[model samples]
Target: MRMHRIGAAMAAFATFAVFTLATAGAALADTAVKFALDWKFEGPSAPYFVAIDKGYYKAEGLDVTVDTGPGSVAGIGRVAAGTYPLGFFDINSLVKFRDQNPDKAVKAVLMVYDRPPFAIVTVARTGIAKPKDLEGRILGAPAPDGAYAQWKAFVKENGIDAAKVTIENVGFPVREPMLANGDVDAITGFSFSSYFNLQLRGVKPEDIKVMLMADYGLVLYGNAIMVNPEFAAANPEVVARFVRATIKGMQDTVKDPDSAIDSVMKRNETADRATELARLKMAIRDNIATPWVMANGFGAVDPARLAASIDQIAVTYEFTNRPKPEDVFTAEYLPAAADRMLK
Candidate 1:
């Protein structure tokens, strides 16, 4: 009986050893990636969560952790500083950042927002019909707002007198509120975000006017996935995997924004399902799945258009060293065109 019991115990111990080795090997195989986002876990951000929940990253052997950032520009700095290996941020801001910090080797790998979401949002009560109308009006803008950062370019391109406009540097939380309460005439924000946020604050849709910067004269790309140069160089395959997983997430989000919003809602308890769904749909319509991206594939930019945008940025920004389109963006890490096509 004693001999039989010893034999059974040895077999059980051998099985446990195999299980432990397999578990350790699996953990070792998975690469941890710290991802930073330009903004909060909102509708536009649901795709990353979808990727996580769907095991897209895991399938790529990447363990990605997506964290919210303060602003688009801030996300750029986060990636550039190497605090995060990869991040999502405004491509225009990245352009400026690269120019400002020439030594830092940060570049956009995927063009997510083909059409920029920069806009001037106002209500009918404000009577701000056109860019020119912005003059002599009180415009509420957060200092760190990506839209507000383009105010100089917008004003110059639209022939609006910047000095005539009373720019109120408002907080992000109070940006829509001040406009809803008639404290400010208009606000600088993303069309999808500020527009829906105003409606949530009891503002009528018909009363709201969204002057998209793309409709105006700011020929700029909105946001993209950026990478730390050293990290990307050391782990090229990992970057490619990250991009592939992200593309999958974006495709899934486009197919069923309703289901995608569920991923975001789980992360952000304060997010209202209806508002975020509307935001996601609006982002898809106006920014993500634009005519250009639909005709071509997603995750890549038009070289000529990007060159034109760089020239436009020069109108307001005096770059010490103007970077070529290749310097600011790269298509190497992105998957094939077939893999990135959105519905």
Candidate 2:
């Protein structure tokens, strides 16, 4: 009887141990991650969709939920609020957020685009050959801040009187129509994607003039991966894995853009597949193939470039003080996948 009792006790202990281990394993596998997007899922977001379709996140032992939000500010805000772990945001906006809320503890992990995609698109026949010619012309802008301010600053910096230009606030999607119908003489657009869309719509290339923001020293980083510093600090391994998977996704998108487009279309059926595919290809070629993205590495962040961007943002936005460049991003979390591909 004594022997039987002892055996039963041992069996119970073994069962408890097994249960505890299983529960811990399950918890580790169920690490929930939420990624907030600066805008709706489209061509620029192909890599993320590719990652999800390929089970890259699952392979990394992470369960990720991708949520598209209003814009960069809202996306970053949600991440800072601890409601989400990661987000896609503009580097300029991230710097602004860091300056305004130093205690938030958010940092950029990777940059999807090396250069700014913002541009001023005008019909060539309008005779607005340069930024200077924008004087006395109606310019449609996405918002009163950021892109608009930058455009005005660019015009002013180039010796054009911003006061002479009539500014109209138009949303992004409506900007093209406004320009086409002559409601606005010129409009802010993404050079790679928006310009491509116009060309697709039978607008002759020579008839459209695109003054890319990057050409005017408005070289802010766009579509960067950001994470809450607290989460990164607490779960370094998880962060590393996430970055690894993301870089792989980016590489896959670059190598086979068509497949990437298919992946994006599968996930976001509302997007215009042809236009989005064209945009994705253009983004990969124009933005991703730059010296910064190609030489240094994919998703790499340059402190000097970042500092310059912060300065530009401060000047454009008329901020009383600008935050330090180091406050916006950390190179510590960039994955090896990007580094490997660059080599």
Candidate 3:
């Protein structure tokens, strides 16, 4: 009877050990990723939250933690400095960074905004109806804003005297408010963001004029998922998984924006759901799901256009060393073409 009881006890211990190992194996399915965004929890950023809420990242074996950033430039710097392995930021700034730091350059993985959202927003009543009108007008922007970063490129190509245009360095939170209160004639901001934000502040849509720099001549690609090349080189599979998961999230967001907005509001309870929803739809229609993105699919760059833009960017930016399209973007880790098409 003693020997039989001892055998039973041994069996129980074996079962418990098996259960513990199995639980740990399940936990090891995905590696955690620290993802930083170019800005706060807002409409344009809602899709990433949707990805998290929808379990797309988990499905791809990525434990992604999405954190909001102060600005696009800051996001780029964070990723480049290795504070975060991945981030969403303005690709143009990456160009500048690559010029300055050749060896430690970050590469854009997923191209979110095919048509750059860089725009100069103004009140129509201010008589700043055209690019030329920006001359002699007080324009506002956060010093590190992506739109402001491209202001030189825009004003240069459009034949505007940038020097004559008075620039007021405003904080991101107060940019639209300052414009609405007549503190500044116009502001450099993302077209989708400042347009709706100004509208919510009682500035009529008709009163607002959004001159997208892309509409004028800036062939620059907008914000994208940037990875520290060192991280990407060491963990190629993780990078691919991250891109694949992001694709799922973006496509899901396109299909049902309301759900994406829900995910966004969850992260930021203070967000005005309706306002952010509207802002999101605008970004989808005008930037994310643009004609080019629709035809060519997402998560890939048009090499010719990228090359042309690099040359065009050189026209405005004095690069310490001119970087090529391949230096800034790569389509290698993009999943099979079918997985990339955004409906």
Candidate 2 backbone collisions, by pair: none
Worst 10 residues of 2 by lDDT: 144-153
How would you encode candidate 1's per-residue C-alpha lDDT over 1-343 as one tens digit per residue?
9999999999999999999999999877989999999888999998899999999999999989989997888778889889999999998888888888889979999999999899999999978899999988999999888898888989888999999999999999999999999999999999998998899899999999999999987779989999999999999999999999999998899889989999999999987889889999999988998888888778999999899989888876899988889999999998888877875
Clashing residue pairs found in predicted model 1: none
Clashes of 3: 0
Best by lDDT: 1
Off by over 4 Å in 2: 1-21, 196-206, 336-343
Q: Residue-wise lDDT of candidate 3 within 203-270, one digit each (tens)?
A: 99889999988899888888899999889989999999989888888898888998789988888899
- Which lDDT values do the candidates have, in the order given? 0.91, 0.77, 0.87
lDDT of 2 by residue, 1-343 (tens): 9999999999999999999999999877757888887777788788888888899988998887888877755578888887788888777777777778878878888888788676788887688888888888898887733456576557655788888989888886777777877788988766765686667667787788888777775657776888887888899888878888888888888888888899878778887888888788878876775766776678777788788777777666655345787777777777664363743
All candidates in order of lDDT, best leading: 1, 3, 2
Per-residue error at 195 for model 2, in Å? 2.8
Model 1: CA > 4 A from native:
1-28
